[model samples]
Target chain A: MQIFHRSTNTISRATIFGAVFVVAALFWVAATVQRSPYVTYAGVARPQPAPFSHQHHVAGLGIDCRYCHTSVETSSFAGIPPTKTCMNCHSQIWTNAAMLEPVRESYRSGKSLVWNRVNDLPDFVYFNHSIHINKGVGCNTCHGPVDRMPLMYNYASLQMEWCLDCHRAPEKYLRPREQVFNMRYQEPSSSQPVLVDGQPYTDQLSLGMDLVKKYKLRTATDIMSCSTCHR
Target chain B: MRNCRKISLLGALMLLLAGCRQDMHDQPRFKPLAESDFYADLRSARTPVEGTVARGQLHEDTYFYTGKIGNNPGDFMPFPVTEEVLARGRERFDIFCAPCHSRLGDGNGFVPSRGFPRKPPSYHSERLRKAPLGYFFDVISNGFGIMPDYASQIPARDRWCIIAYVRALQLSQNATMADVPSGEKVPSELPRFEEPGSGATLPVVEPKSANSAPEEPK
Candidate 1:
């Protein structure tokens, strides 16, 4: 009877142990399966409505960045041109092209293009484009070499720390505004002539420098604060 | 000992389960007032509240001070057309502008190369060159003609930057090498009048109108 009792006790312990092990294994497998390879949510990997290329627009066309992206000075969005805006050119120009498929689809269907946002900020953060642009932050300083990119990609991480570092010491990132779009700021060994529209870059750089002192905008934080960006 | 352990574990489980039940009736209950003068009469009619704050005013937060952007006309309206402002404008211009308009400020971007319609405007267009500052401001603030409004996307300052850049674009299109600063080397690659990648890749251009070609000057 004693031996039978001991065997029963051992069997009960093994059963509990086996059940615990099974539960743990199942959890591990479920976790592994939940994570997919294609998901790039951590960085700017949201799918865009149409493939937009900065390289084609800036480097190739010489169209001022302001032409399509109108919001740099007044608002936060650097606003994506609406369907009607796209129609302005597409109506007469690329009257029939596959690349303009999305534009046509939206126009014909009367549906607003639900463009997936790439450089999205957290809900709590409040980023204003007017302040930065006014204070002399170039679009390329944060966006990277957009003129070279065929498809728009988030070049800078845009993390809080990254923004703060520049804010802490803007001069490190802030150059004469003429250098704002010049991607290879560090490359040139000697003074290269600056040209705008076809004029000298001297005046433009001088204006940017003067504005920096006038505003007393020392750091990104001075202009960009928790409430400034967070709302 | 085993029974005691089981009882403690069961108690803990019961506590956890109790904590997990959803509670929808957690909000405070209050009776609606019959009269409009609830503020002055609430004390006499019902329980007197301890405090009340005024409503319906603009929330004067940090944005009023730190968030103030653009050319503020009242306080110290230094002309934003200064050299520094223009420089900043140039940087922003290149980042955002050069894509559609070529470096030479001609409207030939990758879109044309891809055979997408809509040729960019030439910076040399007389209308654009003579456009007023406010007109430019309006176009940048609220998109004009083919353009869309930039109010929400770009801040006012950046718009100014683009405007500064636009001036540069205009200058570059019209200026000669002599106009360029002594040290500044003229950009080697002239702006492409033709689309860059369209020659071999895209389909043959078909005439949109029935009579695509203009009647030969007779």
Candidate 2:
């Protein structure tokens, strides 16, 4: 006995194939977009125990980055500010504020508030904060304009390609050694030559190249080697 | 049969999604300070063996490390205070000490204005100006009063450099005309000090809106 009509079978098969194709395309797009560095990492602000505003501390008060991130220049990790660091000001200024209750509780109990990590790299990547900072790479180069971020988010895609882009040609991102901490430091205008000790000079690119030599930065080949990061 | 085929197809899609979740996050590793049955102490973290000097941490020079010579704060710097060293000291001081001690060493930093525990003693004050080089080093290495020790944050050499910068700051505040080199040109006019409440001198700051205003005094 014939179980199916011949004409309907072809139409049903085609419809099924079409449906499968549409579902597969939708799935691919969703997976790719979700996992892309731009969507997955950059600008994604994770929740912290307190609504700490970098803008208020850095811009409003003009507190330096080194004030709270005390170890950025010396250690591998740019440490989160300790409870004592918070109480150093909050205990006197916002002593009774409900917003700073967690800070007060942490101070009293001697427990650290578990701040959610925003710029997370895979465990395999070996990133050193001190090396980058010491080599005249501005904090804003990686962290973006943290002084303006009311709620800090991951500014750059902390992906391999993203890191290699800077590692390849660091001169474009390099600033003067003194300007490393100046979050709002702007590049000198190319049209107008800045007067340096009575001599006019208009070569930021050359200056950056000189700095690369002065700082003894590794060549792109050495930096891009597999073991440089993977180990 | 048709219903079974549909369910199987759904199951295949679910399996594909499940395959994506490779357990890289939950790896088989001991977290720091985690309890361990494998070790007698049951601590995953092993204590360093007796007298184990870490690499690059052999701080053998007693004078350099402690800033003391035979139980007394030494008067001289461990390293020569070169121009480069002073520059490094200036950078480190601005980053570390200037928060509490101010850039001018006046102890009226932004933190103090915002009500930190107490204003640190001014480095320019006669008492501090006369303080031996090692005294500042000692204070930085092992904190004075409410201030935390910067030993971990600053290297021993950098601490000495900071001391050098502090001395320079003191001299800057108290320098006489004789202190200036005869060959170098000094500014013809001293900077005019602006009196407080002088409208012309002070930049205009917008008043805080009612919503952002500080709470009324109790």
- Maximum-DockQ candidate: 2
**TM-scores of all candidate predictions against the true structure:** 0.45, 0.75
Q: Summarize candidate 2's per-residue lDDT along B1-218 as a digit string, tens digits.
A: 99999999999999988967736633456543344679864556576788898788788898999889888899898888898798888777877787667778898876667666578888877788888887888888888787777776678888988889888888888989899989866764333322332111212122234244322110
Flag regions of model 1 displaced more than 4 Å.
Answer: A1-44, A178-215, A218-225, B1-218
Question: Candidate 2 lDDT, tens digit per residue, A93-137?
Answer: 778888899999988976557677788666667788988888889
Measure candidate 2: CA RMSD: 9.3
Total clashing pairs in model 2: 0
Worst 10-residue lDDT window for candidate 2 chain A reads A192-201
**After TM-score superposition, what is the CA distance of residue A202 in candidate 2 from its true location, in Å?**
4.7
> Tens-digit lDDT track for model 1 on B54-155?
473333432222222354212222245787677667655554444455545677644454554456677779987876555566665656555545554455
Report how far residue B117 has shifted in candidate 1, in Å: 9.5
lDDT by residue (tens digit), candidate 1, A164-227: 7776666544444433333333321224323222323234344444446755775455555666
